[model samples]
Target: MSRKTVEFVFASAVTTNGTFTVSYPTGYTKGDFSRGVMHRLIALQSTFESPKGITCSFGASSVTVTYKGTTTIPAGSKGIFGFDIAGPDTFRETDWKKQNHIINRPAILRFVNFGSPSTVSTTALISAATGTEMPATAASITYTYATQGGSSPIDGANTDGKLYPARNIVTTVTHASSVPTMTVTHTFLDVNGNQAVETHTTSGGGTSNTITGSKAAAQLISTKIANASTTQTTTGATLNVGFGSKLGFDIPILDSTQIAMEIHDGAMQGVWRGNEILPFALGANEVGTGGVLRRIPAPINGRIVSAYAAVEVANNANNAGTIAISIEQTNSNGSGVTVAGCELAFAASATIGTVVSGSTAEGAATAEVSTGNQICVVATAGFSTNAQFSGSIVMRPTYTVRGTLAVADITTVPSGTSGDIYGTYTPAFTLDGSKQVGLLVWTPEPNSNGTPQYTV
Candidate 1:
């Protein structure tokens, strides 16, 4: 699917603003996600010239854009559907500056190069060697030796009463003055602490007084410096400690272990199956009391943003036959004059599915009677007394040619007659999400006979 590119504009009463330009694209094809993101980002930039950028998350239907910085538009302009723009009292710095206070014009800074994406490596390596020399003798002989021309390597020779004697020194010589040999071989054995090793070599006897200089064909050394490094490492556990590191300096002062917690494995487990109640904070200037945020349990299905139910009943003077009723319903977040809407209305017969008597149900043979009072559902402006809207009602009733009264005459009842209907209605209104709103039902008071008579 392609992404949709939506353009944005800010309408304010900034008179001095030289054509408060709205930067929108020439056109956009509906499904471009990238273009959509870019559009929001640019809009955010336009709102807060210092706006770093906008972060966009793609949902099933729409993309959500979160502005990094606070957008200070005219006072009331920050809401989803705001009519006027105004600055917030609390966050004055974030409030849009008045035309007089517009000391500095807002400007957007563009980063030349954000960075690059990810990838792999492509280099290679090889080995190098000089040359190899052959040994003089094929036969291998072992020789013992001490640290070359040095005293005992061990320092603590005497500690207690008895002197700790060092291992006796020993030397072995293996050399045969054969045909004038060009190379010398020497074998050396070394024993130290708990480790020991033996080495062999053949060398030419230099025509000198003592020994000839010869290269040791092979050499081995065993070292056992008393070290318990392996024993110390029972199990490899890493302890990370640094004051202003990953978690910050404050973590050291906090005991995260004391907090209650639950762990989840990587599996297909329902996150929250049942109801989860949450609270929201209310503004200080709110109509009702404000303190901690209040919470409402989440519906099994979902929350109802808006819902409306309307029932209309039609009746006559005799009130002996079935009263036709039509019900109009709307879901949560239903549209008003400001937004689009969808409504469903079921006619009178289907409105009341069934009726029951003492033992049997009412069939088509039995006509549904009207209840004492009629249910009138109507819309009023602003829910105020002065806002009551008036309109005419006309019922289209059908009748046979041989009928005494015409169907339209039988069904239609002109409104505005006193004592004919007994009901009152209030319009639907909206309160803030954190408010405690309620419906007030009023019934007419009765006279001496204890029977109430209501007049329109």
Candidate 2:
């Protein structure tokens, strides 16, 4: 009934200073996973992985891992790569520890379509940082990207709070050099207090500029680029590439494309048959008819961000009442606090309009919720007829910048020329990590409607 969960443990001390790689069984089915994504990669390589920023991705029929942090992933460091993405119920994680030189972290993975040679291919993997950055003189224009709070923005996943906690970052530039040259450098600082740097410089001959670069930090890590600059020197203002300049300038070389992705861990919503009996039925408006209550729990520590309702079956024209959907927090005393802004309301006076309706507010004080807390759902109308409905409450991971930057080889258009790559912001040149991330859709949940959808 279930595919045996698989594992591949290293018998010897495996080193990941360059890049570690492994091949999966041919035609293997990775269930529902967003694999080969840098930000989506999760690891326990070192006691503190935030700074390490371990990235995982798949390529060449194999998975690769790139360690971005400076600290050595000590032997015995667990959860080096969370390969348990086979099924919805199997998103597993190991405890985090402060051990040094963490090595031999075993991978517990699950998969389908393991054809012949049902084992993983352990190729000699080299661990290395992604390449990307630079500087110049003569009253030159300078731009420095760093934490606005005077700390390191990369020091996240610091569970014990031993590392710096500055989240907000900013950049400043000085304008002066004639026929000035643009220099950009991204330095990867490790927990060991060392550094790995990438540099680039290009000839500049302008007077106005707009340069923009995209960082892989999740939605929570919105960066600020300020020209807290020291006024320019000459007529050449070349920094103005494009406020929204197309993201380019591949360092080392542009061998791949950088994708922006976000994954929601929970949908605190559900569907219901509005024509059912008493409590579940939509008699009239919500004033008297107690709407059906579905306690959808938050899977992780997150905030109630959005809410919406959709009528599957068009309601009668007489249904003039409004439908209000709310997500509440259940307390120890069994009481509920309506999460502010996490509610949805729509006029049901007309027939089914769009396939879906309503939205939610995010990051409210009352909107903050914990794991396992109930996300109660309620719906009502003035006079509801046969209006079948479905609703949802979106909950994203609490941490902004949900995933690490998978700074892979720029393989987009032109492979790239052997020259410095300039940028408006930062780049810690960690290359592509093709980690063995597998997600399966086996044991599909068959619904009464005769359609198939995976429900976790």
Candidate 3:
């Protein structure tokens, strides 16, 4: 790289605030100067008092330096200064190319002495400068699921029949820059409440961060009911067992079974339950007794979102009955109040091994299902024969937990004097040959011989 040095004597020595302009070569503009180059120029120091108190500002095609009132320059003497200017090719190339070529133009130092305006001292300063390159902005974050080691259906015991356990899930956050903070949350259905929740938080300055957490387990309830030989009219059977312990389960049963299921919060207080009745005649309303199916621990406060019951009827010569499944909440008096229900009627010729299902949305009214509730199932024979059926009851509840992550704000650089120059300089002397000051802009090349290349 080649540098152009030009010097001009002051018309008159400056004793008060004044301004001087340095115009760039033709076809060059301020946009060509990189922020790194500008910063280097601003750090230069001069022995002469005039350039000491001077502040520089950039323009489209020139630089204007404003001097304070306290600055002074000797008459008919030499003053030296050095700084980097942009070259035509500086803006056209990449940062790597610019750094390797030292593309900045040579420095032009002009000193205007008092008493000798026409006798200006013009000197071109040149040098090679290099420094570490810092990132200009932060990078965005990337997220993904980490490998989870475990078995499905997380069923702790075989007695619970295929009940699924909570899932242990992990999520990783990554970035090219640094990640200061991160938060992770897990949500799932709860048998005791509307939902179950878990959360995790982490903080550090690095390229990556990981958050580990797990979802709540789902609940399942399974049982078998035999047909009633006598024409049952009321909920007469009693199976004392805990229900809604963790989450809820589905009801799977055979067809032609006259049964009803009910849930309560111990104390015989009904929480929710359903029933199925067999018809004696072709189109008769099947009626049956409601009894306690299971007594379960009270669930956390939450609303029921969904409830369903499925019945599979076996092929029988005489099979004419109706199946109904329902979910209800108990009143303060322990009475059952239906929130949602599903019913299906079976014909005499209904195909053997046929399946019928019913479902209702429980989340609409935000129905509350308290803890320690009792669930019951009852069966009724429509006519002389009892319906042979099997099924399960499944319910899903939701829980919520929240978390947040915030990054610190960046501070701004204040405006003022940069600092004293780092290199050496000689005082201006009139008797010596037009004294010269050279400044060359250089940047170290990582691939080269590790020497800074001078840019003129």
Top-scoring candidate (TM-score): 2
TM-scores of all models?
Answer: 0.13, 0.25, 0.22
Q: lDDT, candidate 3, residue 122?
A: 15
Error of 1 at 404 (Å): 82
Ranking by TM-score: 2, 3, 1
Model 2 stretches astray by more than 4 angstroms: 1-288, 331-335, 353-356, 360-362, 400-456
lDDT for model 2 comes to 0.32
Please report, in order, the local distance difference test score of every candidate based on alpha carbons.
0.20, 0.32, 0.30
- Residues 78-148, candidate 1: write the lDDT tens digits: 22211111111123464365533222323222211101211100100000100111122332111122331
lDDT of 3 by residue, 100-157 (tens): 4344433322221111111211100001100111011231111111211111111112
* Residue 30, candidate 3: C-alpha displacement in angstroms: 49
- Candidates arranged by lDDT, highest first: 2, 3, 1
Model 2: how far residue 221 lies from native, Å: 42
